[model samples]
Target: MIAVSDNLPAGARQPTESGDCIDENDARQAANWVAETLERLSRSSFRSSFTLSPHDAEYARRKGRELIDRHAHEMLAQRVGAAQPAKDGRQTPWRGHPVFTAQHATACCCRGCIEKWHHIPRGRELSAQEINQLAGLIMAWIDRDLAAHPAVTGERDGWAAPPENPKDAGAEQGGATPQPRRRSDAAGHLERSRRHPDNHHADGASGFIQGELL
Candidate 1:
């Protein structure tokens, strides 16, 4: 993981007063809206539709923070001049985080989605003002999920630890095998849950915004 810079450039702090970042009250309001939407969706036949899998939720909570901290400035602050595809064909800009899945699921994954869902236009690069606002919006969605499901995530165990020896995997003396926690390392790039593999598809420049102001 790239080391996150502690210093944000000028005008990069989360909004406090009625500008970029959503204050506590604003976050609460946004969370409430999402909760309500979820509640309504839960009542429908597609009750299981919107919720992330437990494994996916855990991965998102952990890696989303890492991805945001490591790359949000380059993603949201600067201009995306062209689509840059990695070796595997996933666009470099938006790959590697379940947050993009959340963004796609939440209609915040690309500039087109931003335009379609939030009335933000394309063509021009987002200003730092807009960048912080959108970043806060994505964060608010993540915060709401974590707030609702606290047990799903906690401090991550070391990702770099070596695997247990195969001979020891079966346990020297075992009556019944314990169900192990699902864990995964993505070709050494990211550690995630094996049950829920990383959804690394980029949303391109579709959603540069996330969540709607209430």
Candidate 2:
């Protein structure tokens, strides 16, 4: 990933209250919003033209972050007319993450399918709660911007978000999976199960926001 400091023009120091990461949370929220917006863009017949296989999703998931690293480097310059930082030291850039386009390209195929898609990068230590949180953030974002989601509203009006993987969609279509499943109880649900993938994100942008707030 690009060094947070590099994002500033030469001589830009950390904000007096908060340094280089000033816009980091804003970056995460905007990136996710952009991602949901990407999903709504999927109605193109070209979508069918390019269905991504899980293997490909795996490949992208494996390589995407490295790509994020490179793009982050490219994004190091000044905010392209972003809003000023918040009073509490929050930075919210208007342009969103440069990787949003790239992320969308990858997400088109991976939509609702892979649980692994939610996995933290290979070297990170993530908890289940974190992964769910990120997933929630991703979904919550979609809820807010349903109208803003291009795939859903633009030329691809019929385009619905796809399952993250082909197999999952296939199971649903073919009825291979059981139609009915047990309703999960809240509170104890997470407690009884093994760790969830999103716990990482709870540690991720989602968690950072809640945890730091708490």
Candidate 3:
């Protein structure tokens, strides 16, 4: 795995309000939190299992980072930013978008997971700064996934070559491609139960217990 520090440019610290969420404006702290969080997440089999499929990686490349980041922010804000999201734990789907997978892998999928893994408290709407931090982390994961899988851009292994113009890439695909099968609730519960005992904790504290918030 590429070191998280390698992906981010080093910068001097800046003042900010005290909070558990990483200060997105502080480049150094954000980089460290991302690196540490990723490292901790890697120790969990479930989190490590999530990856950007060739198609998803290609989709991200075509959409460009700006659009992907926008999608992440929008999803996070709509699905998770609310204090009492309509469905809470069931809000984020197990598939359909790259950010969804990233959310699961990074433990940013629900309020419970966010509180446990990210130290972001629940019972109140996520602050704008907190939302930005979460978005940054999600984007960092996507960036890492893309960097790790360069073959997605090449015309090999059933993957199509990237188009010269990103906007034109969608038309080249003909139409909207079908997403992979969504994970059934039963399957998700089963997987979580199977992996619960093996979940990794940060700082020796207990890790997220799947279905706890469901």
| Model 2 TM-score, all chains together | 0.21
Give candidate 2 regions above 4 Å deviation: 1-20, 47-49, 53-64, 67-214
lDDT of 3: 0.67
lDDT of 2 by residue, 85-171 (tens): 122112211112323222222221121211223333333322333332343333333333332332221222222332344543332
* lDDT per residue (tens digit) for residues 1-214 in model 1: 7887766565454444234564456556655765665444333221122333344444444444645433444444432212321222222222234344344344445455455545667666665555545555555555555556665223433212222335433432111233334333333212321212223223343212123211
How many residue pairs of model 3 clash at the backbone?
0
lDDT head-to-head 1 vs 2, winner: 1
**TM-score, one value per model:** 0.42, 0.21, 0.66
Could you arrange the candidates by TM-score from highest to lowest? 3, 1, 2
User: What tens-digit string does per-residue lDDT give for candidate 3 at 95-169?
Assistant: 557787788878888787898778898789998778777888898888788777774345533333375554434
Error of 3 at 160 (Å): 11
Which of the two candidates, 2 or 3, achieves a greater TM-score against the reference?
3
Q: Any runs in candidate 1 off by more than 4 Å, and if so which?
A: 1-50, 53-56, 60-74, 77-96, 152-214
Give the Cα lDDT of each candidate.
0.41, 0.29, 0.67
